[model samples]
Target: MVSKQAGVDYTETFSPVVKMTTIRTLISIVVKQGWKIYQLDVNNAFLHGDLHEEVYMDAPQGLAVASSRLVCKLKKSLYGLKQASRQWYDKLTEALHSRGFEHSVEDYSLFYKKSANSSVYVAVYVDDIVLTGTNLVEINNLKSFLHDTFKIKDLGQLHYFLGFELLYREDGVLISQRKFTTELLKEFECLSYTAVTAPLECNLKLQAAEGPLTDPTHYRKLVGKLNFLTHTRMDIAYSVQHLSQFMQDPREPHLKATIHVLRYLKNDPILGIFISNVPDFNLRAYCDSDWAACPDTRKSVSGYIVMLGDSPISWKSKKQATVSLSSAEAEYRSIRMVVGELIWLRRILIEFNVPCDTLTHVYCDSQAAVHIARNPVFHERTKHIEVDCHFVRNSLQDGSITLPCFHY
Candidate 1:
């Protein structure tokens, strides 16, 4: 055990993460079909792989050895090795490939195998694996195979994985972080605060604090967790994204606003996105932007929500990378990002063996932006745009995407 005393650079061992949106999309489809879901945890996952590099440690100065300069070479990866996770992934991928599972080209962690009668889907998050399939026989065989090959603790059903509390129903699954949120509220000593209807004031704009905080670490940590909570809590997405900007030098007002978010959570700790049982596979997207909302940097905020049927699977509210001279440019930039996500989402659906939605609609509130996208001319104002937003326009022309007239 003492051979693992030294820590390795986690960054070097970092593996690709399957997007949460992908997970949500998969869940929406699977739950709609009433498929069984199971989870598995690999014990000492990182230690199962062999080390390729010659990792060596110098002998202790006082220790007697044949040669003072002799070094010890590592044959297997330890828990903290720089290559541990990557090596483990390699070994796992090899094993899965041998078992007729194909690693997805779009999302590497997603492994699947489809036959005439059965299909199995596996979503991997580090050592934790969530399994779902149409055939229980195949799933059990794979589970037993994995257990014999690697020490796996099978956690029955997808009840709780990665802090998400899952309550399955005949209709669909209700996923929330009630326990996590409650503990977070108490951790921040805000369990007694009054709840509010909204997390942030409607017309108010937040900026960096006037002066340095007493201890900025607490403020940073609190905001970080709040941001993670946005994983399942879309109601607080905009507010958390707004407050995340001031993590470097947070002030009292920022802390107060963050506490406002926690209090909002206190309003409904069980508040989360509900995956519905609706069988509709139509893809619907709405993207909007607030131009020059940031008082400090004068950057706009771009927001979009993608729905599988009526339930949201992906949403984001983030500040624009570049300052848009006009509101139209900001909205147009948001269009670019959302369309890219649409393309990626469609590819993921195909990988899941789900049929593509024939008519995908991307709605934008800015009429001027829609007009500009439809008429892609090198206008003097749009000349400054780095990437042309002609993709959505082409989708419209090709009869794939329809820009419905916006009302209200």
Candidate 2:
């Protein structure tokens, strides 16, 4: 639909997607505050938005009027238009702003308002909205107001949103993606495949040398879908990242390894990240890198996970863009990326009034990487690294990041 309305020639078609980290963070905050979260879905969400560009659409076959000579010109947004999402966001933001909600500067989709007596928060991802507040009466009032303005369908308590199953329990809320995982396994025909302990073998090195896949498109699609699953399943992030490197020319061996990941999932499709009511909100991050792991380019892979108390909220595994001379260099580069995320997360948490302790703790398995972060003296061995890697050392000296030794 977007292709028809927005020409294929349009540039900058990408839009920011709400990260799973942001969603989990919002849920954690609501759980901590003992607030009720209500979900709402806007029926025909795209139709509610107004389009700015002059777009013409062919009239429906049977509904076309005989006197109508011109094509239907869109006044409101449609699903396929390139600007549809942005327009919907603008419309929603305008409505919410008029209703006394303040948008988060860091994340535009997040809005909040607090008074002496009541507090309310709203987060929008395209059309899906999760509303939370301290007072039940105020939440319902806001819902009614939104219904009046946008005619929203109240989904009551959120059972599922963006593939994460949300179950409200008396003890706390439980979030998982069991159904999504089960479907993925079945779709890949890995239901009967034997299970494996790890998503990828430590020694398994995938190269682009193997012959081309019989169905290269299918392999690409599978990798793309699994990429989304990684948001909730950090175990597969490294494997997915590894497999994705060959999307341009995926080989049979790469496809086999990708299927191997599915076989592992077949064992327990319900395996998902569980965020419970943990009191400790201390920020601790663990970063690791496999030196020269990629077979084709010999680039290292960086993997890291950040946990709030006991629950793991964010993790990533990606190949380094540059070739590192040593494991310490690779680990230091990974630390730099992880620290960047931590800084942004800390800033967002502060805006939400979450108490993030003064110091952010970053854990590295490599003591040499720790030394690199702490020491100002760049030895001949470390002199070749880019200037950005030195930022970690500066941050440590400025007391912005606290690097402590941690075991995976």
Candidate 3:
């Protein structure tokens, strides 16, 4: 008799997931410049890769097996095999490389190709691919090539991708997850609750080990789903991140906090980040921190927002890995994190051949943190953050970044 199991943690074998920031940034550029964006789905994407190992599976119930003795050997990667994604990735990357696309060092899942006057970009997330470029004929040509090889389903335009719904207008594109959020609220029976103004109460503080234990399964499920919503709903990111920290030993209070987030979504499920068509797509960032916010370990929470022109493209809210002794220290750490994001995004734009003549602007509410970044006077208080200190100072000296004394 043949032996087989359904699945294993495929993540252990392959890690090809694209960063959400890359997706958001790409879409932002597409809409901002009024360029073509298309979606492609590879039909039975995993089946195209040939299997490496000799895996035997039991004959199907309807199969005419002779004496139940014939076990089928896998010739190609199947849908549920642990190595299916990896095999498919290797096959696809080889195909892309043969066609002259260079794999991006900043993001492995992103590939780009450029000619004297034309450029094309491809972002892959498993079986789904989003493509954009300056040349329409080249885009269609590439589509035909991929379709001929992989038998892809060419989903037109980019109205809906992954879990995001794109609503296009004359001035901008609105990205939302109203359908997904509605289903989530209904699934958890939170749709009937009255809407709230905010995802979290200002006084709310989540601790890892406090509060009575609840259904661990339900808490983990709710928290995981909420984390997905954060991709388009940045307002709920801080609260969702807070709830996620307690997934291991979730308490009733954590569940309540998640419910609060659902309630906030109910307030305006259709609302999302707007990518405007404004031509001046300059980059700017805002960073802040809450010193010693966590009651359990007194670790601070760091949050930042990165904007392309006026619309937000990337953001993060999470507890800092280390505890800071002062508010200025916490803010300094937050600055370093956001600055790193800025540098990466700038590099990506450069790769895409986008122009950037003006210096990137960064703003922080803490005057003390800003003062420390602009000057090199290292006293006892500043010695610990010397690495971050020099990081920002060098950028400043190079004229790539600036901390405007009074931000415009």
Using TM-score as the measure, the top candidate is 3
Q: CA lDDT of 117 in candidate 3? A: 89
Name the runs in model 2 displaced over 4 angstroms. 1-16, 64-69, 116-118, 169-171
Ranking by TM-score: 3, 2, 1
lDDT of each: 0.84, 0.81, 0.85
Model 3: per-residue Cα lDDT over 243-347, one tens digit each: 888877888788888888899999998988998888766899898898998899899999999998988989999889887878998988888888888999998
Q: List the RMSD of every prediction in angstroms.
A: 3.3, 2.4, 2.6
lDDT of 2 by residue, 104-183 (tens): 77777788887887778888888899888786877888888888988899998877998988777775677778898889
Cα lDDT over the full model 3: 0.85
* Residue pairs in clash, model 2: 1-80, 2-80, 2-81
Rank ordering of all candidates by lDDT, starting from the highest: 3, 1, 2
